[model samples]
Target: MSEDLQETGAGDRPGPVTATATPTVTDTTAATGRAYGGADPVPAASTAHVAGAGRALRGAATGGGRARRAMGRGRGRHRRTGRVTATDDRPATFRDVFGVAEYRALFGAAVLSWVGDYFAKVAVAFLVFSNTGSVLLSAIGFAISYLPWVAGGPVLAALAERYPYRRVMIICDVARMVMVGLMALPATPLPVLLLLLLGASLLTPPFQAARSAMVAQLLTGDRYVVGLSFQNMAGQSAQVAGYALGGVVAAIDPHAALVINAATYAASTLLLWRGVRPRPLPVVHTERRSLLRETFDGLGFVFGHRVMRPTAMVVFSVVGIIIVPEGLAAAWAPSFGGGSQVTGLLMAAPPIGAVLGAVVTRMTGPERRLRLLRPLLLAAPLLLVPVLAAPPFAVAFALVLLAAAAVNTVLVPLNGLFVQMLPNAYRARAFGIMQGGIQLTHAVAVLVAGALAERLPVPLVIGAWAVCGLLLMAVSVTTWPSRQVIAEEVARAAELNRAPEPEAPAPMPARPPVPAQPAMPARQPVPAQQVLPVPAQHAASQPVTT
Candidate 1:
């Protein structure tokens, strides 16, 4: 939000970098409601008022303001404990998730789109430089690709709520297809091509927002986590393949690559249109206010919420640190004292590590992940701190691999948690905020590292960045939600999912004499409708790299 936040040129931006993984099932979480694989505990309490966990899904259709208030539930309350119980150790298989027809279609479309997008980023950068022979122009074009996420992510993502998610994705894909097609035409001017590229890039936030929202709908429980693992694998793999393919194809004919990029969208359009069934809109136009208001509210909820704010910073920090090696590979590779292939090897390490991390996380149960949380968080950055010693290529690669893997392990479940807590109404806008945060953080991290590399030794810069990252992560850990809090969230999700298959109106309760049970005090709703720049957990599969 591997889910990737795409940045052109270096192939660095992490997408948990856009995929969000769900927490694995456990007895503690199962106590809340265990939506699958077993009986859920019937609470002695009316969980409808159960803080954020209780009211989240119930509040979904209400409005963003209500959802925001519901999500704001767990702040400052980590000191308290919640009822926890359930048991389901069997992990959801990729086969189980992919068995859903719509997910297969979504996956197919997304794969084609990602491959094309990555390839196009490289091809276009080359085309820009070739046409004007200005490295500066080339860089600007690459930067421009990221502008949509920064400037209009929430706004564009907010727009997705106004229509069926499938339609938003389809429309965005088709619009992108037209624009890329124009750019591929021979003799197109650089300025025009750039504009076309901008138009195409701008569609990403909304498209991604829609896709993330849809994924949350299609997958639930451990199945969602498994789906994200696949997304992470495909996205990272696509990055390496795209960048490599783009270089070769651009060398031969940049326009030809552009044509292929356009074709992928065309094919994606067909896949989405035909393969996925359409669903109704999340927020009807009548329910929405001005787009600006929607974005503002979403921002407040995303960033200002107590739990999300800190977690998001942690996610951003981890992704920011893991991405450092890839961007600096060209200058840093020589330190390994290896042959020319060192650059390629070092560049590939993070994504490979990222994929490994995703797999490990999928295999790990929730309790273990929770146990691994703080230690691994520190390890992610701590492992990289030794780079200042200018270790051999093997040592450097190992350190990078270990660090990247640690980051992904923490993030996969976090991505899923964000989805589990938020009301559906705000998920798309939530993704927009996280996506923007990740991209912005990545851009800044890379820029800072690049600038520092210019002024100092590559190893020194990387080591220093990692040290700073370590410190940042230390602070972020303090903000993590307690295990008690997560248990509550899981239970609430279970309760909601088991909402008794809509029952027929019962004959007027024959025994009106039975007294209603006493319920817990309702929480005062926070001033509603705030969304922040992705504080951390991203696009519900869609958060910032998420």
Candidate 2:
């Protein structure tokens, strides 16, 4: 016997669900006519006959054994034509992502938390250096967090996909808060502090993935790009502000700075819980899938796809080259008789440029400026060499800012283009792979730059790195997708965004007029129920929009 389906209430019924060829009808109210003008009584035999006939008709319309088949040829033809029309007209806004009540709360919490994290880093580095009188140990303390992404990114990031995004975010935040709180307790052993920080770092990938996915869901269309740009700006700004504040706070008391960082995590957890709406967990077919294999699949989607591969690879290479200059900024600034403030300025310059670049690129519009990507990619590194002329501090700073702006003009648009190319389902995983690629490349670049700086003057090292970056730019341009490919990708993205046309309701069948019976002395009983026959053509015409 076929099973009856359960009913979900009205609000849950509105959003269209994925359809199958055969569906069981479960209109019990209609069957009993309790929902209609139900004063009339129906004969039991008439009601049974109507229900049986309706079931048979529905089965026939659904094509009996062909129920498991794919959508009909008409749907296939529509899909082949790829003629999706944009229907949803939500206006694009920077604030849609950045200004949402939830996002705003999360943003504020992140600011406090990020600043706290940095303060702890600064305090840890100073404490290590003072205790051991070794820069290497201080460096080790600073570098501890970077190791997690390199070593455990996939394993940790997998957690995000398995749970509800909001829950993952809140839990990660809470976990970090607890870890930092424990670390801040008096007389914490150095090893214990390092271990706690490592544990916190492990939470970042999943937390970040949850956050990224939420942004995609919250801000639809081109607003997603603006949202991402806001995040990029906020993250860079936080680092700058945090490090500067951390330095000041650490100088006063390392323990206090550590506690402040713990407090940031606690506040972040609260904001994320209160601000962000809860989202459903992603569907998974199997609980038995290997985490390693899943991670590899994420990598495959990013690197195996035609457009995504090149986009991801280029972003990876670009971020790496940029890091070479940033990583060496500390060493480079000293050559001009400047201090850590100069280092901070140099580090902050690119993101500041990135913020300006994002605004300009938005104004230019992605569709219009996409063609300029090849030229911008070529020009970015070529512009960086001006900083190597060893100009005065102010001049160097200005040059760095100009170079950063140029690089980000390329970056912001490229990022949007990449997002457009990615499938909606794989956005978070793709973002994870792309970010992981960037992090890995950055680590390598910093290592290489650090070694080079140890041997040569910082300016020479930077100039040489700039030349290498220029070569990478050339490589990026050579691999840039052709205009036709870019157009096709854009079209595909548009198709993904478009909503399908609603089907016209089926024309009602003409009712057979009840014959006027010979004046019946005996009262004839009225039928208690009537079953409406659904139109086969209308059922077949229902479209899949998304």
Candidate 3:
């Protein structure tokens, strides 16, 4: 009678109470308003009995530490972690960009095209210089090729986005191929040759923009980062190979080099046509008007966004500052008692370092990249210090390589983040503006370095530029995003990306819900059913419930 009264009183306490003879997982901790069986919910019989008992006992004394640790482990286990993944700030692999097939083709084409273009440039410059015995004309030839990028890069790039990416890419490749063939014609005039090259340059930015857009479409999340890195690597490789091959061909016969470059373009066209698949065009609005407004909008989009603006600025400053040394390399190298070969080495150093940095980037996991910006940014400038100290050519080359590697490692991931942050509509326009900024920065670096070289010894000028580079790097370090904020943003972006898509509602009988109360007497205990491990096929078919 006393036991019955005690049980009745416990039940009448106006809180959840478990009264079954068999131990039931009645969520007692939740009833207490604060889960006391640890941070995790009380383990049911479905879980390992021993583990549950251990957890329950531990929670009784340790205030949920074990459950919290278990929760943390569960979180970690479910997470897709990697270095240079989409969520990584500085994604370094092609996987970061997503797996868009179009990007792969475009990437391949760009490699061939960039290499051919550079090779042809070097070959043509040498031929012009040799034929006319005028270095100014040679420089003019190179300058004319670049002028189109300055004048029409943004406009053309905008056009790239307006048309279908595949069509634009195909057309550009064909146009370039035709132009290269014309350049190889036996009776081509030098002025006409310059005009042809300029035309090719005029077409390049739009083509590049189309390719860039296609990349976004091809690879969604992390793939974008990976694609960008691959493209960057290809570009760097092209510059190095083109120059080397151009030098070789020029040594043999400039005409042969031009012919080889022309052949390469043809090969590139074929590769692009065959390798990439077609994609449906994005929605277009016919209501748009006013070119200036559109252009300004693109600029605004790029600079107005928080992450994009600072990122672009950092890119512009770092690239501009570093290029000063290379721009003045011709003058500097001879002064340092080495010839044009040394100039080539100086030009190549940073990229070689960049390749190494990229390799290292690929090896590390994505999480490290996110928390690493501060240290990496600071490390970048330190690499240039040896060069600033007037080291030997070998040492200077090494220093330049180190600096290049550091900068590239930072830039690759940042570029990925920038791409992800950009709206789909403004991608090309933004790229165009950024491309224009890059061109302008290059010219500025050259001009400044030239002026500085006139007043200062070449080595001192180089050192000063290196020092400036260090300062700029320091700014980037100081401006690194807060860890907590970055982590939260990354988590949000990942969640949004991986969220379960909504399903179409199933057809149902038109009916209203009817409530019924159950009779509660002579109920038997229900046996716990074991949950079998979910099969992959079944799991895939289960629509994400979010």
Compare the candidates by TM-score and give the number of the best one. Answer: 1
Q: What lDDT tens digits, residue by residue, belong to model 1 across residues 206-319?
A: 999999889888876567777887798889999888888988998999999999999999999999999999888644445658999989999888787654666677778889
Q: What's the residue-level lDDT of 347 in candidate 1?
A: 83
Which sections of candidate 1 miss by over 4 Å? 1-28, 31-87, 283-285, 338-340, 487-546
Which segments of model 3 are wrong by more than 4 Å?
Answer: 1-74, 77-102, 251-253, 290-292, 480-546
For each candidate, the alpha-carbon lDDT, in order, equals 0.73, 0.63, 0.62
Q: Flag regions of model 2 displaced more than 4 Å.
A: 1-93, 96-99, 339-344, 368-372, 387-392, 487-546
Candidate 2 structure quality by residue, lDDT tens digits, 1-546 = 000011100000011112332111112111211111223122111222334455555556777544223222112112232211121112235655566677687667667767887888998898888778999989999989777778767556766787788898889988888888888787878889889989988888888776766665565444655566666777777887888889998898888888898888888888887787776754444554777887887777777777667777777766776777778888888877879888888887777877776665555432333434566665666766766676677776666666666667666655655655555555566666666777888888998889988988877777778888888767656555543454344445434434456999999999999999887598655555643344777655663322
Per-model TM against the reference: 0.75, 0.71, 0.72
Ranking by lDDT: 1, 2, 3
Q: Count the backbone clashes (under 3 Å) in each candidate.
A: 38, 1, 28
Predicted candidate 3 versus true structure: per-residue lDDT over 103-129, tens digit per residue: 556677778888888878887798789
